[model samples]
Target: MAKPITKIDEPILTEKEKQDQSLKEVLQDLSQNADGIKETMQLLQELHESGILGAINNLVEAKEQVAKIAVGQMLRPPVTNAINNAMAAGGLLTEMNPETTKKLMGGLSKGLQKAEEGLQANKKVSVFDLVKLMRDPDVNRVIKFSIDLLKGLGEGLKD
Candidate 1:
């Protein structure tokens, strides 16, 4: 008859053995992610070499002071005005029709170019010249557009 097989009793690990087991597990993990660890080390090295790490460390050290300064600057009249203006512009842009805005911008650019040409030519506009220009189709179109724009602005203000 064949010999009967028996289960062995589990043995308790000693402190050294436990430490060895943990080290082995850590080594296994490091081996598995060796490439990632290497890339991370390289990135860290580059950051350190570029002095960015030191700068970041300093920034962290003075975070509260830096924050206070930034807040103070933001609270200044000019900075607050700029922020408010930017927000207002953003709201205006959101409400505007994209196509109409694009057309208006294009027209403004062309008008600027014409104005530049007039400036370069050193031509002075007299009252008679102004009356004559008013008769021009382009000038008449722009005038009508401006009047309509003003009327719309007035209506918006009333609301």
Candidate 2:
């Protein structure tokens, strides 16, 4: 029988060997993810071809200037007014009942259609015709709504 083993020897890797092993593992990983790498390269190539990549790079480099310009533009009177008007409109919309708004919009659509028909007819309205219109329930309802709206506007203006 051979002599009983007293020591177990393990191989020790040199620094160069360790580096080579790491490189090999990296190459193996690259091979495994070849499809993903190819797709990424293709997308990069498309962005580069479109000049978007350069634009993005310039934008990144001049971020401060771009930001200042944006802020300046937003501060202009017309832009500020637009933003304020939109905010006010949004606030008003939030305060209004959706059902009432829907009804008003529907009424407006019908009113516009009728107005168009009236325009096409090109008929002159006499004082008597105006008086006759008061007898119309639709006309009376609109008149009442207009009066109420005016009253509310006047009340708001008082503040």
Candidate 3:
């Protein structure tokens, strides 16, 4: 025996009916967001009035050419060198101890302050004055620190 036709087994819509339903849904969505669409249009109009929108449109149209030129520039020796140097510096910073770096920066600040004060005093330093200054604990400490720093730098360069 053949199965009987029922409403649940029927086709939902014909092709034309489906297209009309889709169009109605799209129109409803547009109507619901009409205010947002208007705001977006106004923003785009302002950008166009300022000439930026036109420039952006031109850029987009020539994107392939622009991208090729940008890639060529980046591949040039100087640009590549800068990129490499930045990476090396970044790697060096990462390897360094943060606390030591902070301490060194703080010491440099203090040293700068002292140097400024000395400059303001306008005092001439004789050989004897230099010897006397070396006797000062802070000066002696900094001299030792500088010597050690130079030694370490030399060792690193030897590699």
Candidate 4:
């Protein structure tokens, strides 16, 4: 015999049932988000042609700045001594010839300062931002310039 229809199949939800439905939706969303992150990791690993270059460029700039500091420290002791003395002079300004010394210090200090700012700024770039820049004309131009620079060096070697 055909089974009788039952109230158990009625279309009504208890409070707990409603909460369970909401929780399931939230879990599904979280699962999707997690999947998205895994995809991004896979993409990053496979494609080194994106903002990775930009990050390297930033890192190279930072290294150049550090190199400046290292190089500047080796300057004529007289100049180094002057900068040190200027700092010791201490006045309305934190130190004397701040601008001059800063200039002398070069990109290393500037890069370090920028890094400090970036760290403190806590700014985050989204994956969308990365993709956008990777497709940007200006970004492509810079990438091309970098490639041309390497090609020039290679040609110089062959010549």
Highest TM-score scorer = 3
Q: Please report the TM-score between candidate 1 and the true structure.
A: 0.71
- Tens-digit per-residue lDDT, 27-129, candidate 3: 9999999999999999999999999999999999999999999999999999999999999999999999999999999999998999999999998889999
Best by lDDT: 2
Candidate 1: lDDT over CA atoms? 0.96
Give the CA lDDT, 0 to 100, for residue 145 in model 2.
92
Better of 1 and 4 by lDDT: 1
lDDT by residue (tens digit), candidate 1, 3-99 = 8869777898999999999999999999999999999999999999999999999999999999999999989999999999999999999999999
On residues 46-151, what C-alpha lDDT tens digit does candidate 2 reach at each position? 9999999999999999999999999999999999999999999999999999999999999999999999999999999999999999999999999999999999
Clashing pairs in 3: none
Residue 47 of model 1, lDDT score:
93
Off by over 4 Å in 3: 1-19
- Of the two candidates 2 and 4, the one with more favorable TM-score, higher being better, is 2
Q: What are the per-model C-alpha RMSD values against the true structure?
A: 4.7, 5.3, 2.7, 29.1
- TM-score of every model? 0.71, 0.78, 0.84, 0.23
Model 2 quality (TM-score): 0.78
Colliding pairs, model 4:
65-107, 65-108, 66-108
Candidate 4 stretches greater than 4 Å from native:
1-120
Report every candidate's CA lDDT: 0.96, 0.97, 0.96, 0.79
Candidates 1 and 3, the one with greater TM-score: 3
Q: Report the CA-based lDDT of candidate 2 relative to the real structure.
A: 0.97
